[model samples]
Target: MREDTKYALITGASGDIGREIAIALAKQGFHLYLHYNRNEKAIALLQEELVLFGVDVIPIQADFTNSDAISRLQDSVFQLDVFVHAAGNSYYGLFQDMPDQEIANLWDIHVHFPMQLLQKWIPKLQRSDAGRIIFISSIWGEVGAAMEVAYSAVKGAQIAFCKALAQEIAASGTTVNVVSPGMVDTKMNHLFDEEEKTALLTDIPMHRFAKPSEVGEVVAFLASDRASYMTGQTMRLDGGWFMR
Candidate 1:
């Protein structure tokens, strides 16, 4: 990677949203460091696709559940122009029945590791002309759900983390923001039954789940020069599913 080519690191690059973000940023002339825990094949294919944009596609992997897993990533991120945290999971179960490990792992994935990596990227991000930090949060973070209590909790934490960190680093010219997307059409929502899916569809004013491409567009904008003034904002792409 050259010093002049702008760099963007996207976690969970094999995922629906992360993959779209990779493409979106690539289109914006960002050399990408695509991070994935598994699914090397998917990432390889995505890397192939992104190379058509004529930007560098560097695929890296790390287990988000482990604290020291992402330490090696420090060596790869030479210049981080944009940092996008899109790696996360959703737990669908009774809140009381949730195991302690489930909550801990969820928090580690959605909150801890992201903050850790962001801290490491702060210096490099500050050096870039366009420094942007974007987190792909959930609409459930805004409006709690009956079955997704733990998911909502960590997501709420992510939102709060973005707000606080935005202020802490505002003087550095780095813009931090969270993109809270509603029921996005992804494998993460495969657990829902036909009836439950129908019920969820009715709640969205648009009568449709959000597309990953739609969320990617917002993220790309925040990373672009036009959105330099935006920070600490939780922009929703939920189709009025959980309007504030």
Candidate 2:
């Protein structure tokens, strides 16, 4: 890694949104630590794509839900200019049928892991001339979802966490914010059939699902110096889904 080159450590980098964010960051000459729990092949392919930019790209695997893994991550990455916590899991079921373990997993990934990473990297990130911490939340986190009760709870807490942490780190030159997306066209929502997709799309004022690359570009700008004054903000990338 070049001594002067800055780095962004993005969790869930194997997913569609994560992969696009990696490309966007690479285009801006940011070295990347693309973290994934599984999908070795996808990470390998992403590495091949990223190499075209001639930046340092390190693909790492760590289950963010595990406390031990979180500790190891803190040890490995001492400094990060951009920290994007995109690692998340979702369970779509009624609150009555939701098992205890599934509920725990939601909080582990969405709430605990993000705050843990932010806490661990506080000193290092503050040392940077400019640093940004972004949490990938969902519109469900904003208004709360019916079947996605656990997911919405955890994600909602993350939004609150971002606001509080943003204030704490403001004087230290670090920004903390959340990006709440709605109905992104990713594998996560592949389980939805054409009819279900159509129903969901109709609710969005834009009448379409968000492309992964669009979210990526938004993240890149938020992480850049151009957004220096933005902090503690829940920037809604939803296409007016919550409007209706």
Candidate 3:
């Protein structure tokens, strides 16, 4: 709570990628508001681990699909210098066969809730000397995936949202950007079998999937003062895949 301390809120802090982001920020002396929907035990353990970095870590729980999630989140944190939207899930299946409820959940979790929360937090972010807003989007957002049609759609929406929001808020000294990662080695990608993963490796010029920590490192850099001039940009962390 020191006046000189920097604070960051990272949603989905329990996930592998989220955990890495939390660790990276903690190492940089950022007091964290670690948000998670479920997995209390996971987040609690993460909090313990982060304390070693000498930053205050507060865990907040809210189901992004719930209508009142925005209120719950807004009430939990009083100060924020950075907000990272890392909370998301992918629906893998034919777009036509995807259920109405699943699509709604995807939109609510990835887009609706985060947008509303940012709306509430913008004023606070503007007060900071260097505020940051980062979205952990997917490479599939830039290039659509076959079975993940709905997921691709939501991720793409995130990219567009950051681009527009960045322009609107640049004058306030706050930057908005997207980190679109490709084929990260996490539980989300664990849905694919070993053979499937091998095939995916062949597609990536790096011949391997991204580690969660690699994504975290990029996010930490973006949250730092070094990224002051950067805004409304989507940094593709796709390992030479889907270059644009």
- What TM-score do all the candidates reach, one by one? 0.97, 0.97, 0.98
Best by TM-score: 3
Local lDDT at 147 for model 1: 88
Cα deviation at 165, candidate 3, in Å, is 0.5
Best of the candidates, lDDT: 3
For model 2, residues 1-244, the per-residue Cα lDDT tens digits are 4458799999999999999999999999999999999888999999999989999888888887689998888788855889998888789879999999888888988888777877778887888887889999999999998999989999899999999999988998799988999989999999889998989988889999999998899899999999999999998888887764
Decreasing lDDT order of the candidates: 3, 1, 2
lDDT of each: 0.90, 0.89, 0.93
Which sequence of candidate numbers ranks them by TM-score, best first?
A: 3, 1, 2
RMSD of 2: 1.3
lDDT of 3 by residue, 1-244 (tens): 5679999999999999999999999999999999998899999899889878988899999999997877988878888999999999988889999999999999999999999999889998998898999999999889899999989999999999999999999999999999999999899888998899889899899999999999999999999999999999999998998865
Better of 2 and 3 by TM-score: 3
The per-candidate count of clashes, in order, stands at: 0, 0, 0
Weakest lDDT window of 10 consecutive positions for candidate 3: 67-76
lDDT of 1 by residue, 193-234 (tens): 889889989988999999999989999999999999999999
